[model samples]
Target: MKIYSLINEFSSLDPCVFTLGIFDGVHIGHQKIIKNLILRSRKKYCSVLLTFHPHPKEILNTNKKFFYLNTLSERIYNLKKTGIEHLIVHPFTTNFSKLRTKDFLKKILHPKSKIRKIITGYDSIIGKNRDSSYEELKKISHKYGIKVYKVNPYKFQKKIVSSTHIRESLLLGNIQWANRALGYFYTLSGNVIEGKGIGKMINFPTANLQIDSKKLIPKQGVYAVKINYLNNMYLGMLNIGINPTLEKENRKIKIEVHIFDFFENIYGKKIDILMIRIIREEKKFNSIQELKKQICMDKINIQKFFSCEKKIR
Candidate 1:
């Protein structure tokens, strides 16, 4: 897929079918809309996806903590897998947010432009103050001769699948529900960094990860996960929390993973952690021995879990 940092950089004159959104996780709901877009564009038109960088929430919700399900690069990577021909990641700023619904449509969907159709989720709204609904969009786009299509909400277990719901699930450590909504495992990618070597002392050395602050972290807990390093997958257990047993004075959250039966130096290397299931919530232990004992049990249970998962597959 070809990616452009700005809408103006996309100079293709070929008529295109496009959809625009933050598309943070590219979850099932977003996938359904994109699928419709690609189907509508097949052979006759190019399939285009337009997303915003830094997310609109980051710019507008200045007083609230806004965490993104995927970083800009991760979102691009996920979108590429859906067979989009072109992606426009427009820079979002205060000025851009001020564009009224009609003016925004005129700029991007003018009668002279090549964008022929737009596919969007059923509930999607845009423009200043999010005042434009699907009905409003259709009315405005009619003047520009652009067609509009709305994909019904995608649902799993009777609940609507959405990025917001997935984020809530992750924050609550509801991995199964989140994964079901996403249609894939929730992933966190970062570089390995030096740590206090406390895991090593317990015979379960870990690779400390330095993740982007803007990326949403799951609830503080120990979890069963799969690690991707150098394109190889390994079973592992990850802990996302402060080490209360070892560091009484420190309260900063830490993310560390111990790959079973693997002991290669990976400091400074990047790895992707795919969350599978939550094991247990992080807590303070009475002593180092107590913490080590609990971790041993965690490894055993996680191994069994993977074994059963393999059998089910």
Candidate 2:
């Protein structure tokens, strides 16, 4: 997939079918749109996919904290896995936000990108003042001689699939449900960094990871997860919390994971944590001994969850 930051730089000799959106999680709803776009593009013999960066909400609303399931690079990585050929990630700015619905289509979508068919999720809306809708988009597309297609809703367990639903589930520590809707594990990748080695002192050496601070973290808790490092999969018990039990005078949040049956120097290496299930909420203990005891229980629970032996595989 080719990624371009400016619409003017998009140069697809083949006619293109495009889907425009922030696509925060690229969740099932977004998948439906992209699937249809790719199918349509294949039938029409064209390249496909146009997305935006910095999410429209980040550009339009300044007061709210911006949260993302995946970082920009991660999002692009996941999207490319869907086999898109031409991916345009135009930078969102105040000037882009001010463009009227019709002007945006004529100036950017139609002329610059040469989009032949525009596909979008059913709930997509655009334009200044949020005036554009699927119905209105059809009207405008007709005037400009561009075909517009709105994908039907994607649902899981009778409810529509959406990034908002996924976020809520993750925040509530519903990893199973969220991953079911996402059609993949809810994964977080980060660089493993050196820490106080508290887990090691407790007899369970952990690889501390510093995740992207801007990305939304799942609920603070211990979780049963799979750690991917250097082409090996290891059963891991992950903790995301303030380590209230281990800290005596210091105060800081931390994310640490103890891989079962594994001992390796992984600091400075990239690790991918794929959450499988929530083990327990983070809590404080009376002493290091108590914390160690609780960690033992966490290990036992994780072993049962994975139905694996006491060894990491």
Whole-model Cα lDDT per candidate? 0.90, 0.81
* Steric clash pairs (candidate 2): none
**Candidate 1: where are CA atoms >4 Å away?**
none
Against the hidden reference, what TM-scores do the models get? 0.97, 0.93
Write down the TM-score for model 2.
0.93
Worst 10 residues of 1 by lDDT: 125-134
**Candidate achieving the largest lDDT:** 1
- Candidate 1, 176-266: lDDT as tens digits: 9999898899999999999997778789999999999999999999999999999999999999999888887888889999998898999
Clashes of 1: 0
